[model samples]
Target: MLLQTIFYVAIAAEAMTAALAAGRRKMDWFGVCVLACVTALGGGTMRDTVLGHYPLTWVEDPYLLLICCAAALITIGLARFMEHLRWPFLLLDALGLVVFTILGCDVALEMGQSPIIVIVAGMITGIAGGIMRDVLCNDVPLVFSSELYATVSIVTGVIYFFGLQFGFPGEAVIIAAALIGFALRVAAIVWKLEMPKFVYDKELR
Candidate 1:
């Protein structure tokens, strides 16, 4: 039940993020909905496909698709209000990232996947949607350039795995991992923490 609730929250947050991106691009309502769905569901779809899980979540539960569409529509109506709530949205996005990471890790664990596969699945579930969103919007991917975004997911997955291996209660593991991951992400955003960028100096060559 807790996992399901977090999953829904994650999708809503991701959908809103996508809607905001669409608004920036001045897309039509239909385009906004399409992008929102892609942002909310694309990652899970990709993860399930790679894991050979049949019947994707959105496919099996059409209500989730409706939720994404509704979120986009609501975002359209609240564009100005949303613009003023950037910090809130950033926090929500951080929460969503943690939830997505937990969900991905849990799924892989249930499937008896190897440690590496579990870590990769967590990353895919956490970042694939944003990658697709950025590509569609013709912008640099947040995971590629943002402060410790993808790294947060990978670390969170590792933490969750170790927590389970060490016999932590399932609920405790989820809550602790989510809180830690969200905190790291929020701190990165607040403190402007980032990985060093590599700039190629062609002139030197």
Candidate 2:
């Protein structure tokens, strides 16, 4: 349930961003719609594939894809009105990352996986596509940015695992982890927090 919720939320967010960006760029109607759909569905498709879900979640449930498509189309048509709310797009993306990261770890734990593996999977599911998208778009990946994006996701997954180990309620664990990750992400964005830069090794030089 957690995973599904995160997937849908991500789709909605990406579609919104795509539509808004398309409108600002004055893209044609078809181009706008296609970009929105791609943004929305791209990440989750990779996730499902990595998880070994052959048909993929959107394929198994056409309505899910339809929701993304409809959201894209509607937003594209109304993009002009949304041009001023770009901050909402950033928030949505961060929110989705937090939720999805938490749920990824939680789902892994529920499936009787090891904590270490859960953490790794959760981080990958959370940011792998964003990394790919950034590369494809010739932009820096959030993973490589100074915003502590992966750190936040990593900590959230750790929190969820530890919460579960401590006998906390599963739903509470998921929510708390999501909140922590989101809070950290927002703080990093607002305050410009980042991981320390790596120092060059004089020996290697």
Candidate 3:
């Protein structure tokens, strides 16, 4: 029950941040809602579609769409105070990333997917929505350039998977995974820790 509640809150947090991004681009109300939905739900939709999991999450639970839209609209109304809430949103986003990854891993595990595919699904669920949002907003996806984003997701999924394999209780594994993942993200942000970059100065055929 608590996990499900946090999942909903994370969805709203994602939508609110996406709403702020849409506001930066001067998008209309409808555009805001659209962007919010994409940012909040796009990752799960893609994960499910790729896995052939029927009844895409929002399709079966249409209220999730309403939640995203509501969050976006509320964000617009509270835009004035949002600047001060940047760190809060960042924290929520970090939590959302781990939570989404765990849930994605759960879905794949339930399907008896291979270990690698399970981890990949979690990574997709963690970062793909933000990628879509950035692309639609004409910006670089943060996961491609940011500090330890997808790494955090992959690590979290691996931790959860192996812990469960080692016979840890499900709830204990979740709490441990979420704490470690969230801490890693916060550390990355504070230290600007990042994967190495590859720079190609020449054009290749």
Each model's total of backbone clashes: 0, 0, 0
Candidates' C-alpha lDDT:
0.91, 0.73, 0.96
What tens digits encode model 3's per-residue C-alpha lDDT throughout 143-198? Answer: 99879999999999999999999999999999999999999999999899999988
lDDT of candidate 2 over 32-133, digit per residue (tens): 666665566555566556666457656877787677667878786666677576677778888878776775675566557778878876886677756655
* Full-model lDDT, candidate 2: 0.73
lDDT of 1 by residue, 120-199 (tens): 89989999999999999999998888799999998899998889999999899998898899999999999999999987
Q: Estimate each model's TM-score.
A: 0.96, 0.79, 0.98
lDDT of 3: 0.96
On TM-score, the leading prediction is 3
Measured over all alpha carbons after superposition, the RMSD of each candidate to the real structure, in angstroms, is 1.2, 3.6, 0.9
Off by over 4 Å in 3: 203-205
lDDT winner, 1 or 2: 1
Residue 6 shift from truth in candidate 3, angstroms: 0.8
- Stretch of 10 with least lDDT, candidate 3: 1-10
What stretches of model 1 exceed 4 Å from their correct place?
Answer: 203-205
